[model samples]
Target: MDNQKRTMNTDAVISIRDLRISFGEYHVLRGVDLDLYQGENLVVLGRSGTGKSVLIKILVGLLKADAGTISAFGQRVDTMSKKELDDLRLKIGFSFQNSALYDSMTVRENLEFPLVRNARNLSRGDIDRAVEEALENVGLSQTINQMPSELSGGQRKRIGIARTLILKPDVMLYDEPTAGLDPITCIDINNLINEVKERYNTSSIVITHDLTCAKAVGDRVAMLFDGQFQRVGTFDEVFDTDDERVQQFYHYNFVE
Candidate 1:
């Protein structure tokens, strides 16, 4: 439960302080503070609409924060220009909840998209090698030519991860990685997440409501509620908390 025991490195890869966001009049994240260290998986545990997705979007520079500072790898994210943010994104991999693979593209093409867009200087051989390595990392090299439509939900998710891996990101963001999969497939994806982290030595933020995924992938868990992180610690530490709001999340009593 102790953060010192949970984290492998004291170096913070991502630092967010008093982060706040809103949509017109409805506030989403009020004032959230979080620090993700190198080589650690920090799980954000929150009910639906608690701004878990928004926080990561801000981290990746996809969304603008109305207040507070976001620092990634010691660079100020809030002030980064579009070009600078694009370069930053190359080091941060995001696996979306819906898999977000190109339905029309084959597995290989989906994996090649990032390289083609960002790694423009890579030779044909280099791109091919990158794709092969990423697929092998996800245990899907044999499915290289298969279309997204041909794969199962879990396989599609793996492909999404492979696509992210092709870029060799330093930080990984998984948004509901196991959502919509069967229990068995969920477990498979969970294991794959662990494998990727160990293989790449990447720091990550896994946003999910599934406690099983949290316990399996998280070095520390933070419960997001009422536009802020109410509590943060190891899975058991947060699970055992007496805070009523955290207990509501623990018991699946989400506010509607």
Candidate 2:
């Protein structure tokens, strides 16, 4: 693509250039570059403790990169003021590695919390409509009154997804959406991720170790290893590549 065309086509939902992150002496990310385009689902795959979660934290401003440029929605995120960060956050939805629901609230209340806290201009009726829409989107319209303790693992994940959807964020970051679920629930969540993209035209970055889940949701995949992106390509290209480390990791985790 030409420079102008590339710029227009990119209009990237999130951009990271030369990103480097460290926790004291341990560097988690090293000069990584990535661009998430509008309405695309990009999965970052890596083994345990490979900085997948930290990458997402950097995008959302929960953790700062030691050195890098992070731009979200065309604004530089790394240097954003607190107000700007909060504004940016409101446009991005995050589903934590754990569901991170409040035990004190029922599913209905949990879904409404963001709308109540951040969407103060919305009327009571508008909030209710948004909550119902979010629940319906995640196939949880009937579980509105259920508390966190009353739900199954899969149900909690779905509820968390619903909460994320309530904001209708332009970009959604999912951290291990199906980590501990049953095989059937894992597939269900994967399908739900696809559905969310189709329904809302939302862009996403999924952090996952599940190769099956990765293939299900990703239009393209990038392997993160040794604090950098080892390789990135379409599922077919990356998975079927002849590189020894890529082949070895896939065979070790996926092939019996």
Candidate 3:
């Protein structure tokens, strides 16, 4: 956000400082600084190639940053041990762009996968109750026995979210949560994002290029431009700027 070194926000669930990453000659993230606070949804707004997804990857340890300090829930992500990182991941839920469901597994089976693997000590009854609660939260209890192929686009998205929420994570990372959905379905997913925060009390970062999704779920919107977050504010405040890069982003979303 600035040339000067900034102190990390201790209260923030996630704190990133002067983050930089590059591939070959293509620099994906120049120097990103951000904070995701407790119980708040921070939306990272950008186009398809502006490193929005890359930022999420860095947060969850899928990708490493070339330079920067990343702290997740008081733990420095850049220097964590393998075992520590795995434990941290369990507390941070990530909903992928595609539903990422196992086509062979039923909805119930999909939800049980993570719980059974990570929380191996849970009994049969515990697993069943967790699956049922997650489905109910997403209002998809009836789809418990159905396969992923049988679900509509929206239903698959809900089930994807159910699988993520089954862990009761402390933080959530949503990668294009409303992508590939109709207008009504997009709105449904937006409402579900908010409901997830309320019910789970989880700090979240929602990555999207969709203006409607950003407006609906974000408490604060950070616009990514040229590998850096040029503007960070509420939905209206970010779009109200006179910066051309910011204006171009808003225009693109408007036309899309």
Q: Can you list the residue pairs that collide in candidate 2?
A: none
- Worst-scoring 10-residue span by lDDT in model 1: 1-10
Instruction: Give the lDDT of residue 137 in candidate 2.
Output: 86
My TM-score estimates for the predictions, one after another, are 0.92, 0.94, 0.96
lDDT of 2 at 220: 86
State the C-alpha lDDT per candidate. Answer: 0.89, 0.89, 0.92
The Cα RMSD of model 2 versus the native structure comes to: 2.8
lDDT of 1 at 1: 32
Q: Tens digit of lDDT per residue, candidate 2, span 7-69?
A: 422468788777899898998898777889999999999988889999999999899899978
**Candidate 2 regions with alpha-carbon error over 4 angstroms:** 1-10
Candidate 3 lDDT over 4-68, as tens digits, reads: 54678798899999899998999989989999999999999988888999999998899999999
Model 3 pairs in collision: none
lDDT of 1: 0.89
Candidates 1 and 2: which is better by TM-score? Answer: 2
**What would you estimate as the lDDT of candidate 2?**
0.89
Deviation (Å) of 70 in candidate 1: 0.2
